[model samples]
Target: MTSSTHPFEQEEVMAYLDGELSANRAANVAAHLRECAECAALAEQMRDVSVRLSDWSVEPAPANLTKNLEAARAEHVVAKVRKPRGFTGRLGGKFPFLRNRWVWAAASVAALLILVLRIGLPTARQESRQSEGLQLAYTEQSRSADTPESKAVGTASDNFKVRPAPPALPASRGSSPKFSSSSADGQSNPEPTAPMIARTASVSLTVKEFAPLEASVKAIAQRHNGYIASLTSNSPQDAARTLSATLRIPSAQLESAISELKQLGRVEQESQTGEEVTKEFTDRAARMKNARATEERLLDVLRNHTGQVKDILATEQEIARVRGDIEQMEADQRSLQTRVDFATVELSVQEEYKASLQGAPTATATRLHNAAVEGYRSAIESLIGLGVWALQALPTILLWAIALFAPGRWIWKRVRRTSVSQS
Candidate 1:
């Protein structure tokens, strides 16, 4: 059919009306639309449809929509340029939903939530267990308040308060008591208690006399069967003397030691901290026990087993590994025990210092004589220093002077000769 008579000629005219056709095609369609009444009517109808769609009011697109569209277009171009290969490409092409931004975003959020649940749940459970253990320890301490001194110390500090421990559980059958919420029933288990806490304290004091305070601190440590881990005294001539000491006291004696130490001076600042190492200690003990068991099993195997040389060597290596693990675990247990047994006290003592104005002034004549002698000495020293510096630089100066002198003299002679010639 002739171009003007073809059915698609009307579509071309509509495309021209919407400015969708290339310039050349649009020109042809425009020419056809002007001559043919049918094509012109079709173009007019399409224009009306466009106007009607524009009139249907809708919310404006979000500001980021343009950026997203541009990004999508770029990604599309890249995908087309380098068509993906393999199973991934085939799967993605078959399921176009996988290419959606929202789908990927949702998947990422789901993955993050799963990861958080996996990691956070166990950590939260462990913390809850530790807290239960601390509660149990505090509860045990509260039932028997035999120490009047500790009570007094607690009463003296406003920040200190006795937290009554939670209700005790029924005695279970074992050397180490196991407390749980559940009792032969399918229910939630009571939280487990940890072992003990390593406590520490820091006290800063302003004392009238540093020496007496120092002596008192040592006495207090000795009385408690504790020893001074370290002691430092800083005394400046015109300033107050300060004493810093780290004291290690038996955990049982910590309260009494702190109270007695405070009595030696005016307490300026004091802070106490208790770190519950019960869980850590318990874990180390369990590990050590397991290691010992493993070592014993290996020892039995080594003693009883009669096998090939290769088998014996392999068994020996296993025994060695088990022994090493046992040693390491034992060391950890000892370190933990040491911390639980001894509490650290960091004490800082500063003397309430006063400046003294008791010294007599020097005689004017004597002062003048001293000043003159000092000035003379300084001048002599300065001269000596200058002579030494000049001597040190003498060779370099001479070398530079010699290097420049010949050239300078020759240039002068040449200038003189030129001047003479000119005259």
Candidate 2:
């Protein structure tokens, strides 16, 4: 048996020593080792090292150590008897390092509450602002409508306005302006109450007939003077296309379109929302109008002022600046107009097909192979997870378990032994 032929690797030999190799594999290794002198000698050396390492010992504990241990045992017994159950555990947590289970539990609850507040507060604020805006809209609508009820409401508003109006406020406030969407108050009186914001509706579903549905959706979009901004369908599990598209439909037609889309498939999930951009639209329109006015005045100065070449150049520059402003405002106006004309519908489409009940889940051998592979992977993963946790937590777990459970177990054993002796 030469090292060149029958010799095994260190890893293989170690695995065999650990009893990890299967019977057939281990038998092959053993047969090979019988013919391999170097490997047999190496195995013998490993055994010697193991035995030599096992020969070390520790000194015997002193008699005083025993006495001290007895005293410690007595204290532990007293603690077990008098330990204040849940309250003690809870109170212990207050001492920073000293606090144990109850403290951590309370802290966890407190942290959870803080997290909820952190997450939920902004949402609550948003809801509150929405509600307040709605209320404000209703108020402004009544003011603009100028009904008898409005007159009564106006009286209350008049009293409110009597609080020595700031110079920034317009003398005669017509209706609440949408620009007042800011956190600031008394900035501007809003234009006649904005058109009520329409509700937003969206749906995500899988449809086997998605290709056909896409055509229908496209047709609907065009009929309503809307356009599809995006559409995509790319998936293997689907024989029919998967469509995720943002369709721009008139706000008025949004609900109707969504209903039609739902008719095409079983809706996996659907949502409806309302956002009042009326205020934003109104405010932007007002600002753009003011900017245009300023721009026009600059242009007028540019045309009429035929002064020095420098002044003419400066005037032209001013006109160009004003024109730029007008262009920007025009863009803003167009965008707002588009929003009023076109509401966005975000749709997610999937194709679901009914299959033969008896013929479902074919390919048994492949499935079994996959199952075996997954099982092995899962076992390895579980073993690694256990090893990691044990390595990380064993000391702490052992210490606490010994500190807490050991005393009780010792007392129980002592009592049982005494009773047996008495018997």
Best by lDDT: 1
Question: Which candidate number would show the highest TM-score if scored against the true structure?
Answer: 1
TM-score of each: 0.48, 0.38
- The CA lDDT at 253 in model 1 is 61
Q: Taking the tens digit of each residue's C-alpha lDDT, what string does model 1 give over 43-148?
A: 7888889999999898999989999989988978766545468533543454565556697799679757854563445435444544765322223333233645
Local accuracy of candidate 2 as per-residue lDDT tens digits, 1-423: 343565557667667766889998888778866877777777777778788988887788789998998898897755454545552233233223333457669756975785456444543443454566332222333335355433441122221111122323322133232222322342222232334343445788877665587787787666555578898877554344577888876554565667777777888999866555556666665665455555555566556545567656755676677677767755665566455445678888877755433546758999999999999999999999999999999999899988989788989999999999999
What lDDT score belongs to each candidate, Candidate 1 first?
0.65, 0.59
**Which parts of model 1 are misplaced by more than 4 Å?**
1-195, 306-325, 362-380, 405-423
Number of backbone collisions per candidate: 5, 9
Worst 10 residues of 1 by lDDT: 169-178
Q: Cα RMSD (Å) per model?
A: 19.4, 33.2
